[model samples]
Target: MVGDDFAKLFRTFEHTAFRLEVRDRYDASYENESLRKFLAGEPDDLPWIQDWLTMISAATQRGLRFSRVRVVSLPLTDYSRFGVWCSQFTNGAGEDIRYLPRPEATAAGLPNHDYWLFDSCILVRMHFDDGDGFLGAEIIEEPAVIVEHNYWRDAAWHHARRREDFATEQRIERY
Candidate 1:
């Protein structure tokens, strides 16, 4: 249930891969340069990011669904702003990326933890340190747990707004 092992699930899912991102920031090494550029008020582009974008593009082209709902706080963090910026590319590549303000997500009774639900079956819970460094992934196979995660996914998706719409709103609020 480590990062590499968890990633293999992406290639094996038959239909859908849904992610519920509850963290305001992820300390993934690959994104550091992009984050730097974002903070410097420069282009958000990072060459290595193309690898993930390509993977997403390929998966969607093969007819699989890719979606994620990020639960963010009202006053956006620098990382959250960067996420909105990156969503443009990810969403354009056919992944349905959405945002849910923390208050709304709380009203929907969503869990604070982050996880990925694959084909409404396997639940991969993400573990991270206080510094936002990813620790590993924990795979859950119980039907009851899967059902609960699935319910959370549905609730989050219902309350989320597409990236395009949310980005505009964030720009207006600038919070």
Candidate 2:
């Protein structure tokens, strides 16, 4: 549902003014074929995905200064190359960085325990359920909402364990 909005949003925000605070998986489901394929080492990199990375890399070049990167939940494994991607945008010194998970859901709940934060931006959740019973969201933007979800992610992060083994690999750049 949000795919179209994201498509348009991506185009608008792909430039310097726009920053991201991704909470859940950056690329999840077959719907995000461009990102998934690129992550899977497919030959073609999606233009939007590439643009997204380019923005992040550009932000990094500017000393990793973004509005914010609040990670709430990470469906993707911590050991995955995704961490390497995060590092490229978050950690520049190349030192292993361990996140400080919130002990509980913050007063402002969004989603994800990992909690990627950014300021002065909008969010759109793409609900991909193949059922007429549900109205899948194509774009969602509201303040004082998504509190329950954000709480859930915070709870999970508190209970979640860090992937020490994967963190080691990240330090070595094996991924």
Candidate 3:
């Protein structure tokens, strides 16, 4: 399954793990309890979050770069806001997180789907349902596809603002 593939890739990648996330809201299964707690104004002290942070930190300490660009729309949705809140933990774990407004991302011609590119070679295109529930991922190893995704990543990265800067601009209160 693609889920297992993602875990394998995450553990075995040699250099960089880059992700481009382009969704406003995700299904309940994708967010469940943490999102509920966040919406209810609870502190972000979730145990699973710490586990993810530990994984990211270990990867970074091994010299593997982790970065992500999240494309968001104006008048943020609840999920987007939660994502911004979660960015604090990920950024602290040495993952470079950034934000790109949807209008800007559209203007730059980036794809609408989400994907993960590992070491600028293996491309894993992620699928989602109409309601934004994760479906799965498809691994694409073609040179041309990889090259195109690499180009998109560079462009998106260039236009995205760092998480801290974006949080300040968006007036998102950091916990």
Q: Which candidate number would show the highest lDDT if scored against the true structure? A: 3
Residues 1-175, candidate 3, lDDT per residue (tens digit)? 4657678999999999999999998675646788988999887576667877998999999999999999999988888988998898899998999999999999999999899999999899998899877888999888998999999999999999999999888788877
Ten contiguous residues with the weakest lDDT in model 3: 25-34
Query: Tens-digit lDDT track for model 1 on 1-175?
Result: 7856877998899999999999999988888888887888876556867987898999999999999999999899998998898888888888999999999999999998999999999899999999999888899888898999999999999999989899998882222
Model 3 C-alpha lDDT versus the unseen true structure: 0.90
In candidate 3, residue 100 scores what lDDT?
98
List the candidate numbers ranked by TM-score, top first: 3, 1, 2
Kindly provide the TM-score of model 1 when superposed on the true structure, using C-alpha atoms: 0.94
Better of 1 and 3 by lDDT: 3
Which residue pairs clash within candidate 1?
76-175
lDDT of 2 by residue, 36-118 (tens): 55367555423434555666456556544333333333334443345444444333322223332332224334343222222
User: Whole-model Cα lDDT per candidate?
Assistant: 0.89, 0.39, 0.90
Residue 61 lDDT in candidate 3: 96
At residue 172, candidate 1 shows an lDDT of 27
* Every model's TM-score: 0.94, 0.37, 0.95
